[model samples]
Target chain A: MKLELGKLTIRDIRFSEESKISEGILYVSKEDLRRVALTEEKIKSADFDIARPGESVRITPVKDVVEPRVKTEGPGGIFPGFIAGVDTVGSGKTLALKGMAVVTTGPIVNFQEGVIDMSGPGADYTPFSKLLNLCVICEPVDNCEKHQYESALRMAGLKIASFVAGLGKDIAPEETETFETPDLLTGMKAFPELPRVAYVQMLQSQGLLHDTYVYGVDAKKILPTVLYPTESMDGAILSGNCVSACDKNPTYIHENNPIVEDLFKQHGKTINFVAHVITNENVFLADKERSSNQTAKLCKMLGLDAVIISEEGFGNPDTDLIMNCKKIEAEGIKTVIVTDEYAGRDGKSQSLADADKAADALVTAGNANQLVRLPKLDKVIGTMDYISKIAGSSDKALQSDGSIEVEIQVITGATSEVGFHTLSAR
Target chain B: MKELTILTNNPSLKESLTQKYPYLRCGIEYRDVNFLKLLELVRDEVHKGARILTHPLDGSVKPMETPYKSILVEKSDPGLDLNSLDLIENAIMSCRKFHFDERELQPRVIKDFQIIDRTLMESAIDTSGLY
Candidate 1:
């Protein structure tokens, strides 16, 4: 018998065997073949471990497998690019993107309306330091209580002093307690007249804008911070523990601040990302069953790497949030969870899982550079309509392979009209 | 009654209670891991009015026990596995948060693990009580 082996394509190979042996072809004589068979029998006496990248199979007669001369693409070419989405928990997109899971929010009222609010004096506008490299970004500072803030800032040499200290006035109640730390002085100074424009400009001057990944843009404008200020309450409202007042418009906060527009104008080219407003509810399912289903579904939607529970544990909204985060983090994805709270130390209302989930979501969302919005819909039909909206009324929904596909689940009627128009338009 | 103590891997949450709630007197014991056993121990303790604690790096134990005291309402911990540890960790983290005492809670780092580096352990340390 004749045996042959050779490379077929990039990272691929083929082996073939034939009954007739040819001269000058690394062939063995009949006697030699019998001797080889005897040698194989003898080799069975010894034990050895073998490893191979691709599958290996044994053939009794050593039949020939034709070596087809075909072009092939390596793993590098076929691998999927980053995929992300922001949808309501029960929407079932989570199940679609399981492998590339980046950031997932809880339930939301309006994901497209979501925004990032960093302006005014109380914005805590600190330059991006190298120490914050490992720290995940969180919103609203409510998640980061005084203790958690102090700990996070401890290495950075910043501390949480008094919340009411720097508001341009001596708002510190006459009986307000004070901390004996440098943070009090620094915070007081930074707060009174925060140069929001100068601060972001200076940071941008340092090439921070270029360093960060910004995602999303419409044909007309970039949507870096989808300003859903309704969920973006003022820090003062957040400070008062009045959860109901947390919703504010991001555009209002941005438009009101001359500094924000100035920074945007300067770095808008570099920070060409779009924003979508989403509610805190989108990320946090109302119940455990919904949370798990949403998580599992989202994982499927995104194609996440691995889903592991947080060191803090599992179940509940926090656990659901963290597990979703871990799935993204394992892939080294950047996410950002836009919210009005920090990762508090006390595992009281929200668990570390919850906080970390927000952090991971923010970091990954930031990295993916995709704007997702989760809005609450009063009507079930509205959900389908929203999906249709995202799918595009003028264009077909593009698939992972860039092929046009139609989803007829709830948007069957909408897709029909779009499909007819698309075909006729084509 | 026999003086029973709850052992957890989370020394930070354990230490917070000692400083925050003066009325509650108990020691939070730290163990390397039996993880499941830790949950059983926490449940055993919370039932007997014992304090429980947790850390992000302490690994999973059980869910947190809810509403231990009026101050410690809305505590939640869902252990990695469906066990008691998740309950206890959530309970402790929650208690440490909403529970208001005249004095602020102070959390201290108790270095018990030799394998875990300082940074990993430090992150796990919830120093919220100190603030």
Candidate 2:
């Protein structure tokens, strides 16, 4: 399949009389945009706000960050399966709004959400601080269930993103790049002399609030299977998880996955970029073993020399990481795993809950348990009333002086295992 | 009374332990014993009801923490038979393994493996508990 991803770098975002893009500035009609999210009966109230880079703003209880993009010339629409109907995508042209994100806020399930600081010492630890965030704060109707609230907030974010991206469909793209992958037989035949490399991408599929969706299907039901590299590139996978603010891959990261981009960068020059082996991190031990066993068997059958396995969450998923590594290495295939650490406040405890000598080639994405003091921002977009009860905070988190103490885990995408950020520990 | 078995290969250290932790005065008994002899004693004690036993392990290593165990094993001689001590004797399989299909660069190469995958895991000496 072939996909041409067009990019338009957004320099500024502002609310105006009508939504349009001009001179790299995105003007949004707040009333019209708010209408898109408020259509859902579960959402009681909806509002649109923009958080610029280097602003004195703090967004709390963030659910997901989505990049606005429209499928201009594809077989299926953007974000196919969730907002768009389930149809084969990633074969034609898709336009992505560069340098900005649609951040969804209003964590009705208080502790399950994350924080985003547009500027501060806290901002330095997160990637979202660098983007021009168009945050959508939505409140669920009275007595809404946590699951219903999560969906309400998630759909609101995607609806806003889809509405904004549709505006860029007819505009001239600033840049365009094409990516293509051949069938298994052809890929092997073309790069007969190069080493075969594939990616074993583990999806966060534990359950309930901690879930990820693929083609609008729950990831927990999926066994180990193969995917074209471009499938994830065109919004085939999305995050619906409330696992941890720092480590969970938001919908934005899944669409612009760094591993997929970097591996494709070395497609034929250094290695034969093969297919992606997708698997789930189920809660059951038997499910973990079965998924990993199937993943390893596929790697061996594909004649892959090596694979890069990237994980989504921490704790229970660490076992799945080791199992995939050990079982794959047992088939004479070298594997490297990407993951983060939760080594305690002192940074002296064991990093992972599981380990194996077979998992030797490993890269850590920093320790999420490190504490930091977030200075008060001039403007707070979401409420700070629930800060003390959050996972990374204590009763003393909200100080009298207006500042708060919290672990980096409270910050969105602070310690991503997909090598998305620069923070790491020795 | 709990028997404090000192499984030591040094005679002077044994003498030092016996002198340092003297009986009746400290309300405890110290016995000098070999490593194999301690295993035989443990096997005999297993048949009888053992009680109120405690052994302080090295704080650095916790075996249970790493369930899929990987340890550094030295090339040593075979151990004593404990069937005579009323213990069920399982047949000894080959302890030397190459579960990784690794090519050896030199003789007597040391390779690490997850303990459960190793043939001798059931019989493997989990010395972490014994120090």
Best-performing candidate as measured by DockQ: 1
How does each model score on TM-score? 0.22, 0.76
- CAPRI quality band, candidate 2: incorrect
Off by over 4 Å in 1: A1-268, A277-279, A282-324, A327-332, A337-426, B1-80, B97-99, B102-131
lDDT of 1: 0.21
Which candidate wins on TM-score?
2
Model 2 DockQ, alpha carbons vs. true complex? 0.02
RMSD of 1: 27.1
The fraction of reference interface contacts (C-alpha pairs within 8 A across chains A and B) present in each candidate is: 0.06, 0.00
Give per-residue CA lDDT, model 2, range A345-411, as digits (tens). 6777667656789999998898777889999899988888666645456556777889998878788
lDDT of each: 0.21, 0.71
lDDT measured at residue A100 in model 1 versus the true structure, 0 to 100 = 9
Candidate 2, residues B1-131, lDDT tens digits: the string is 43323222222333432353354121122234432343334444434533112111100111121112211111111343232222111000101110111222121111111211121111112211221
